[model samples]
Target: MSSSTLFSPLTFGDFKIPHRVVMAPMTRSRSAQPGNVPTESMATYYAQRAGAAFIVSEATQITPQGQGYSFTPGIYSAEQVAGWRGVTDAVHAAGGRMVLQLWHVGRMSHPVFQQGQAPVAPSALAPNAQVWIVDEHGQGGMVDCPVPRALTVSEIRAIVNDYYTAAANALAAGFDGVEIHAANGYLIDSFLRSGSNLRTDAYGGSIEKRLRFLDEVTDAVVDAVGAARVGVRLSPHITQRGMHCPDMIVTTLKAARRLSDKGIAYLHFAEADWDDAPPVPESFRRDVRRAFGGAIGVAGGYTEARAQAVIRAGWADWVAFGRPFIANPDLPARLRNHLPLTVPDTHTLFGGDERGYTDYPNAG
Candidate 1:
């Protein structure tokens, strides 16, 4: 057995996971078309990586309106729930746990996916980001996002209800828990930042007002399920897609405190992973640790050594890996044994068949 802290057991309330190596959520865009349902191939793909302590599933839209990219799965429909049931069953049968990530793209979307209607956001702002869109002829490419229409107060409440329904649906689909995707310049993230959310209503303006949407969604989800099975993700350091805000770090810390007060199971930080990305400061990590008492997890470009170092520093309870898990199905075992990892095919990272998805063999 490995002696590293990464191999050590950790508890998130009711869940006493065997290791601290988590499988971070990644958008692979390989769901079945037309209905955007999870497929048997997806079940196999997740089952192959059951070695992770627990898997946080790819970002799944809570409602049709939440979808941004082509072929990403949804959790709102019965067919989608049934499809995910198969995936959860496969993961559980393989002796692993998984959580569904609830997502809404907000302004990071195109009208093509919005039924020719403008995408919705806290304010009418464009992300200056592009999302992968598939044309009618089955070709996919990046497309620019247009300015979104501002969501009214009633509509904002409706989205919170949508999150509640999605959380309940996730439980019905056999997932162990659910993670609110409030990071990455998505709907909830936009509301938290001043730049994207210029609304003067109860949902925006001051930092406290800005956190109302996230608080309501968190409350709704916690009420739908329970505090023990809910996790919230936040990205305070990310500045891309016009998400930068002078008060983001303070806002994130305050949000963390609120989430902690709500008794959520964990707080996950989705750090920027680009090669030139600024480092997530240890001071910030310490501040978050003080703000939230629950298990704290982080995901970016983490190698085994880096993961181990973070855990040893006492700043994080678990370290989530994204790309490394793509090519290494038996990642925990490989890290435990100090085996070389297989690099994933970059071209096949999103929207493809089993070639780069599940064909990568586990180390024997």
Candidate 2:
């Protein structure tokens, strides 16, 4: 209870958060074989920080086609479900609540990762970054991203089924809820942003049309798993690779309004991340909170002081911790005791041993 306004309890989705510190869904890319199944080590990692009010699992691909990065976990297969079962069991045993983040990389994925199939997106445009392709030994090979094949109307409907499948998997795996990864230059983001989506189809024209794909995906997840258990993450300003949501205020407000109709659980708005990324004004959060009467969680490089400032001002219901949780596994205790944060080692961020994963100390 000794927080600078960061340790207060808040409602996130269907669960009551003991503290506002949320462990963000960072892609560690360490899933084991066959279908990106989470291993026992992954469960141990999450359970170690069960004191967190809530935990959002790493980006779990909804289907094989949804995978853009290698080793990223998935929740669609029976094996994957059993794997995540171990994760949820660990978290719950440690008295923590966790949600699954379903993702599809869209144009960000390489054909090399899709069993030699071409990557697909709203349009045939390729993102401006390189995708790490996996070799026979599962090593990363950074290569230029290939242009994605345009998703036909039929293909769009099929992707909707994938969301439902993943949602069911989430429930079967004992996850308290599910988060739709609609932001951060992924498939959903590509469809929502005007720059990437140039299709003349019903899903790509004006703002309303651009929102169709996302709306459908949300509806599917909600239908599969009740609306009260669903949340969406959106990065309005983070321009990943070549992706850009320049008119973030407009898109964010509209996206909030569109999602409002679904009566969904919550909205996690990712303002910006990069050092040069534009700072999202508090007005945007106010706008989203106004448009979507449901809960709103805000993230992106916010320190303890800044996080408390926004929450104290009633701008957000929750603040997700990314880097802090990575280095300081005992983050909640650190915050409660006013302990200094440990610096995260960038080298072991993605695919590495447990040194940086769970070895950080909270206090002397």
Best by lDDT, which number? 1
Once fitted onto the true fold, the runs of candidate 2 whose alpha carbons sit more than 4 angstroms away are 1-4
**Per-candidate TM vs. native?**
0.98, 0.95
Compute the lDDT for candidate 2: 0.85
lDDT of each: 0.93, 0.85
lDDT tens digits by residue: candidate 2, 1-364: 2232578776644778887888888888788966788998899899988888799999999988888877889888889999999999999999999999999989888876777877999998888878666678856767888888999999999999899989988999999999999888889999988889998979997888888899999999999999889999988767776677566568778889878888888899776766777777767767777899777788888888878888888878788988889878888788878788988998777766676776776565
Error of 1 at 76 (Å): 0.5
For residues 51-82, what per-residue lDDT tens digits would candidate 1 score against the true structure? 89999999999998999999999999999999
Report lDDT (Cα) of residue 95, candidate 2: 95
